[model samples]
Target: MVPPLVLDIDGTMTRPDDSVDPRFFDVLPQWDAPVVIATGKSFPYPVSLCHFMHIEQNVIAENGGVVLSGEQVTTNGDGEAARRVAEEYVAAGHDIGWGQTDLTNRWRETEIAVARDQPLGPLEELAAEHGLEVVDTGFAYHVKSPRIEKGLGLKSLAPLLDRTPEEFAAVGDSENDVSTFGVAGESYAVANADAKAQRAADVVLEESYSEGTLSVLEDLRERA
Candidate 1:
């Protein structure tokens, strides 16, 4: 059987331009098992992707701070605390960079996201002071509780899907994906993956971006 899949969105499923490849809209819905979108993005992003793709709403969002499986939702981390840290970061004179109407975090429930262009050192310092942690997803830096991570999200979601963490295949291309890679039975990092992700994955594909994700799915189909 083709195992269920957990995928990171930004650098993994997106094209070089950052838009999701249209091919996935055609493919993912037809997969034999569930496809869970795991990312550091806010809840609405992945949930919306599933909605538009005509797939089930299985997601691990906010870098594992929130999870959704059908009607079941589980939340971890402390969004309030993360928000405090971000406020302190701003007080320290750094811009969160998304501006006042920042939709990047508008619907987020368990963590705060900062634009990648901002300095990481200050964000890290502020987060540590608040007993929170900062994770770089290649797309943004997230402030969240240290205990929350995509691996934990997978563990929480697995039982709900009547599967084990080891029954899922994971694919990604950044530091934020490392935890999920460690928990998945099989993991793939796209050719453009950072060193951390490449080290964590079982295989590093030659193709980059969504092309690499397609390669992973194709290989899984053959194995099945």
Candidate 2:
């Protein structure tokens, strides 16, 4: 059986400007197996997208801080530590922003999602002080517990789908998704991915963004 596909959202399925490729919503539903959109996006965003596509699969959001399976949402990691770290960044004059609405905090659960414009070195240091980790998702940086990784989320969801980590593959374009790559037996990175991400991937596709995603899916179909 073909392994289920886990995907990163921002730079993997959308243009640099954040607009999704028209083909994604069209082709994803055509796949024969399940797809998990494992992204650094907060929980609701990907969940709504999946619903819009009429695809059913557990989603890993908040850089693996939260998992949504059907109507059930499970949160993992240290929320208190994450919030403390976010406060520190805000106090330091970093532009820390949350999800689009005020209620985003009600569900994000694990990591503090913030703008990626600031240098990660210092932010990482601050997160470490709080016993947290910083993950760069290309579009943003997440401060959360080490336990809140995409790999962990995938493992948590594996049993539900009756799939193993080796029976899974993931495509991503950022540092956060590296955790996903580690657990996924087969890992892919788009050409536009960061150097670190490319190094971690089993295959780095020549195409970028959604086109790269489509390429991997096509290869999977042929293999199946």
Best by TM-score: 1
Task: Provide the overall lDDT of each model, using Cα atoms, as 2-decimal numbers.
Answer: 0.93, 0.82
lDDT measured at residue 188 in model 1 versus the true structure, 0 to 100: 98
Candidate whose lDDT is highest: 1
Across 1-224, the per-residue lDDT of candidate 1 in tens digits comes to 89999999998999999999999998999999989999888888899999999999999998898899999999896589988988888998899999889999898889999999999999998899989888888888988898899999999999999999999999999988999999999999999899999999999999999999999999999999
Superposed Cα deviation of residue 9, candidate 2 (Å): 0.6
- Candidate 2's displacement at residue 70, Å, is 2.9
Could you tell me how far off, in angstroms, the CA of residue 132 lies in candidate 1 after the best superposition? 1.3
Clashing pairs in 2: none
Residue pairs in steric clash, candidate 1?
A: none
Error of 1 at 137 (Å): 0.8
